[model samples]
Target: MAKAQDKEAKAAAKKARKQASKERRQQLWQAFQMQRKEDKRLIPYMVGLFVLIVAIFVGLGLLFGSVWLLLPLGIVLGLLAAFILFGRRVQRTVYTRAEGQPGAAGWALGNMRGQWRVKQAVSGNAHLDAVHRVIGKPGVILVGEGSATRVKPLLAQEKKKAARVVGDTPIYEIVVGNDDGQIPLNKLERHINKLPKNIDGKRMETLEGRLSALGGRNPQGPGMPKGPMPGNAKVRGMQRTARRKG
Candidate 1:
């Protein structure tokens, strides 16, 4: 009797998960449809990508005389190509919408791959000038976004504060924008990734604990929300799908 009950519970759980997944996909599709209305090039781009992928695969299959074996493979590869193109388009859309918005830097930092602790809006002013802090194996990175003149001072001040806590550890400063000395928004992740890894995992943990003592304090106001920007549900869905595929 207990074994039968367990089986029933497992079946019910599976059904619930399936329903949830179906609902999520529906939401993602609806969101994608709405975005498509504004992004006229999206469909054409995906179609082109699919055709290119299929052509390459089919050509290779014919050359190898494995048309039967590779036909299905071609279809699968084409679908994946389209899906990846969709994700890239969604990412570009999200970034375009986020550009010049307050807390945009924080949003970019949140999307960064790897285990970095991000503290947003650690300091800011009425003009939306803000400083965000990140701690990782690279040590401390202070990112300032807003007017360069105003943010320069903010970054300097934040650096001093962080240095006090992280004595001898590297503290890098970056300004996100398209100015002469600033890194572009799209390249922000790559820039962070390229930073020298000065500390190891154990040092990272110690640094995190030390910084945690600083606690949360928003001088201007609360930082940007921790995850994807509001109204970016479709982008979030695409990100999940891409991650799963990866």
Candidate 2:
């Protein structure tokens, strides 16, 4: 009886994994279809990369008199290279589309994977400009997105509020834009991650708890969508999938 139960459990787990795999593939297909509509060069670039990688490997194989042995490896590596290229292109496309939109910085911050405790739209105004709060090893990061002129005051205001609660915890303010002093939306995550680690995990948690008392603002500016714009969230998922599967 135990053996039968164990077998059934194994089968169920396998089935679940298969279902998840199927769903992931479907999501990828959907993303590819969506991206292809706007990015005509995606397939061509992928194919070109695959061919280039394979040709290089084949050349090396010929030089070493091991064409047959290296051929399969080459094909496998070529496919991987192509997939990674696809992922990068998808990521770029998503960032490009999402950039400059109201709450875009919050959306990007919310998507970051880490020990970060992110609160989006912590402060904003009627113009849809927003300040997002992030707490991590680097302490507090206030990322503002929207009109550069409008966002500066919001960042400063939010920074003051954050300082009142965070005390001496290192607080960093960033504006997302293409301007000289601002960080681009795509590079936002990298920039934040590179900041000096000023606190430990325990301190970060304590900081988060303290900041929670400060509450947050949800400015539903006219015409501001409640979540990421259509297709933006889906593409972000595809970007993660690409990074993992590639």
Candidate 3:
């Protein structure tokens, strides 16, 4: 009976994995279609990289008199390089489109991978300007999106609130935009990742617990959409697939 149960569990797990793979492939294909419309050079760049990598490998194989042995390896590497290029182009296109949209910073933060915790629209106003809070190894981060004029105040208020609860924990403030001293939406993730680590996993958890009492402001505040930006549903799926495969 135990053997039969184990076999069934293995089969179910395999089926679930296959289903996930299928979904990922579909999402990637959709992303490719959307990206190619705006990214004319994407294909050319991928093809060029693939050809260049394969040519270099072939040349080395010939020099070593192992053309047959290296040919397969070269082909595999070339394909991987091309796929990486495709994924990068898709990501660029997505970020470009998402930039400046309401809650774009929150959307980006929500997708970040790691031990970070994101709270979107922690403080927002009628104009859709909002501040998002992120807690990670680097401590607390308050990211504001929308008009600089309004977001600045929102960031300040939220930072003050967070400081009250976080004590000595570091609190970083960032405004997402193209303006001087502001992090662009596409580079927001990288900027956050570069912050100096100020806490460990246990410390982070304690910080989070303390801040939890602060809670988030009304998410349904004026002009805030309850879900992702319009037309972003498909793009969101593609983003996940690209992150996994990239």
Candidate 4:
């Protein structure tokens, strides 16, 4: 009986150890994946970073071969690595915190692969929210993810904005959710991409010409209501919309 009890205790310890090891490995994997994902230009960027770092150190080391510069430089490099690590940690934390929240779609869409004009929170009401429009071949797509009763009105307002520039361009509106009338959050982008392209260069050029006057405004408000701020439009085609709320 004592021997069986001891065996069970050993087994439990081993199991716990295995679990800890697995968890550590999973954390490392997640960290690595996050780093890789955020840095699509990983190789070149890192190489450039490393080269610059090495050059600085080489010059500094030559200038002051004494312990003071070397030690300080080592500390700086260590801190830089820590900063990179911390940045990724912050990003993952922000993402984890945003999961299942109201405006998660904004985060996902802003992080897409192309030059999309994402105007966020174009219109919002007590019960619904509307993301503003414009895209490349994708044309105008109003994305609403809130109560259907409220979203419809939000959609109408957004549609009106699109029509002013979209003219006869193919326009689509979709609500993000699993409800009977909504598109699931995960499928939102795929559905948008899968839609037929509606605008030609001539029309797109004309649309841009019309909307050019509307680009001087700021897209980001104080803090975005419930989810991610559209980051890429600043880098991508997301210029400011001229319209402002009174």
Supply every candidate's count of residue pairs whose N, Cα or C atoms clash at under 3 angstroms.
0, 0, 0, 2
The better-scoring model by lDDT among 2 and 3 is 3
Best by lDDT: 3
Q: By TM-score, rank the candidates, best first.
A: 3, 2, 1, 4
Tens digit of per-residue lDDT, candidate 2, span 1-246: 999999999999999999999988998888788778889998999899899988988999999999998889989998988878877788788788888677677777877777899887888888888888899999999888888899899889888887887888999999999999999989999999899999999999898898888876754455444346535567777776765675
Instruction: Work out the TM-score per prediction.
Output: 0.86, 0.89, 0.93, 0.48
Go through the candidates in order and give the C-alpha RMSD of each one to the true structure. 2.7, 2.4, 1.9, 19.5
List residue ranges in candidate 2 displaced over 4 A.
1-3, 218-226, 231-237
- Per-residue lDDT tens digits for candidate 3, residues 13-105, read 999999988988888888888778878998898889888888888999999999888888888999999998888777777787788778888
Name the better of 1 and 3 by TM-score.
3
| TM-score of predicted structure 4 | 0.48
State model 4's lDDT. 0.58
The runs of at least 3 residues in candidate 3 whose Cα sits more than 4 Å from the true structure, single-residue gaps closed, are 218-223, 230-232
In candidate 4, the residue pairs with backbone N, CA or C atoms under 3 Å apart (3 or more residues apart, or in different chains) clash, namely 214-242, 233-238
State the weakest 10-residue window (summed lDDT) of model 1: 221-230
Cα lDDT of candidate 3 equals 0.85
What is the RMSD, in Å, between candidate 2 and the native fold over all Cα?
A: 2.4
TM-score of 1: 0.86
Model 1 lDDT per residue over 1-246, tens place: 999999999999999999988876775576568658878998898888888878887888899988778878878888888877776766677777777777788888987879998888777777878888888888999999989999899899878777788989999999999989899887898899999999988888888788778765455644544443546566666555544444
Per-residue error at 199 for model 1, in Å?
A: 1.8
Per-residue lDDT of 1-246 in model 4, one digit per residue for the tens? 999999999999999999977865565455445555655664455456655665677678778776566756755674465445444443444444444556666655665445566666666654425454546576767777656777687678667766776667777788777788787665666777787876666666676666554552224333345444333322111111100000
